[model samples]
Target: MRYKGFVIFTLFLFNIITIKPKAIDEKDSLYIDNCKRDLLVLMMAYSDEIRDIEVSEDNYIYLVLNNNKKIIYDDKKEKNKNAKILDADIQDTLEDIYPLDSINSVLEGMDPGRGRSYTFLNSIYGGNQNEIEKNLDFFSTYCGNIMFNKKAKAGEALKNALNEAKELADKDNRVNNYIFPISGSYNYRVIQDTGRLSPHAYGIAIDLNRNDSDYWKWVDKSKGSKRIEEYPKELVKVFENNGFIWGGKWEHFDILHFEYRPEIILKSKFFGDTSKSNNKKWYEGAPLNDEIENIINIINSKL
Candidate 1:
């Protein structure tokens, strides 16, 4: 009887050990469901924007959006509008414009915009699905960079660049110098003639402390070719590390402007080193300015 009782007790313990929870914890289950829902939304958004999707080995998709007709229309419009009547004879006077055949040939070889390209590639190239989903939030939220100035698919590149920027900003203390909202997109304009969409439209760009910055439009063109100065090197460095390029680098500069143009930066070989090219460095052995010191002190006190 004693042996039988012992055997029964052992079996009961084994049964308890083998038993699984009958239901998932409600909070955890809810979180998982929400994540899945968010991912679905992101995938749907991408699908809606692009076509010709083929999965790559890396899990990114290669897709194309048709734009050849639009380019051809633009070319023809320019040519027809510029035909001039000189000495009673109508002459086609636009010198440098390419022939329609050339434009068509070029368009035929070009890929669709960067956003679509990256999305398709990413989908097929296959990284962590959860990580990709998180990136959707990062892109959709405009967490790191502004969107491109046009509706073309390259907007996805801006989103990816912004994500890289956010990661860098979180690591750097100089980011505290500005109190701008690092997340969410802003509305801004592109050069009117460029026919490009503003990056902010795609929800990827951030503008900081407009009051402190200078813009070329604010300056008188009659002033004879003056350049709008850039923000401090420290600030520019923080931005560049996150895959942004400063407008201060442009001849038509907007000092407060920083956009996610990682492709440009990468192709231009402008890595994030914003220190003075000379031996003199802005932050090296230099005392923090009164404003910066005060800000630092306040931050330290809080800590």
Candidate 2:
């Protein structure tokens, strides 16, 4: 009996010692599992334009375009040096990151859309003012003639979303109050106080209902009123569902702004579709996820 017990223990110990953690496969090595869905969708959906994507030994992500333009993403916000996703900050499931049901829902400074990969954007959209300018097209909405990136699919996305909102307004006139009389889009310039170009420069952002909009910079710092709940949640939701990120969610909130950033909506929905119990950090892969691919499929079909 003692010998049998000893053999059983030995076998258990041997099994434990021999077991290995799953190796990070080539796919996972090139693209962290968390980011693979978003990246793959981007590549396959734009396969004609995008050639390949690779990861460096140090884990920097590179997007190689058909035009041979290479864009690298190396921003590591969380996990200190251990961040696994390029631009992991914004590429996260944002609604999960800042739960709208929470007491103070506006997680200021935690702007998930602010992690802009300038090189990646310029490569995908146009590189310079001259290149960007030629692609611009003006679409007339009830709001006004909004100029935007027609070739990049941004103009059409905005137009479709606004048209849907207009349809909703026809049913309930209140929706019209949120969108119009107009604010500007397609401004060819850099952002004030920064060298970076605004999404407006790419003609991919719009300002709406400027009178009701609250800008953080315009506010006196001593007033402590940066967190106003003015932008209609319904209007915000409509824009967000259509691939736009609201500036009202930023610490440096600009209540009137909405910029087209489909990836954010994709990542947010990916998280929203997964297990709620696994509230791990963004880098950690979700345990059981099959929907992001389907979501991407639907998005691809639309595109």
Which numbered prediction scores highest in TM-score against the true structure?
Answer: 2
lDDT of 1 by residue, 1-303 (tens): 999999999999877666534234544444333222222222223333333233345433223323211101011123332122111110121111111110101122211111212222233222333433333333353343343332223355555444554555577644444425543344434444554444443334556655433455666432212222222355565555444565555444444556654333332232123222433322222235664344334323322
What Cα-based lDDT does every candidate model obtain? 0.36, 0.62
User: Per-prediction RMSD in angstroms?
Assistant: 25.5, 7.4
**Can you give the lDDT of residue 236 in candidate 2?**
75
Worst 10 residues of 2 by lDDT: 95-104
lDDT string, candidate 2, 83-167, tens digits: 3223333243322242222122345346556546566667777889998888888887766677888754788888877887787
Q: Estimate each model's TM-score.
A: 0.33, 0.69
- Segments of candidate 2 deviating more than 4 angstroms: 1-31, 44-48, 56-59, 75-105, 220-228, 273-303
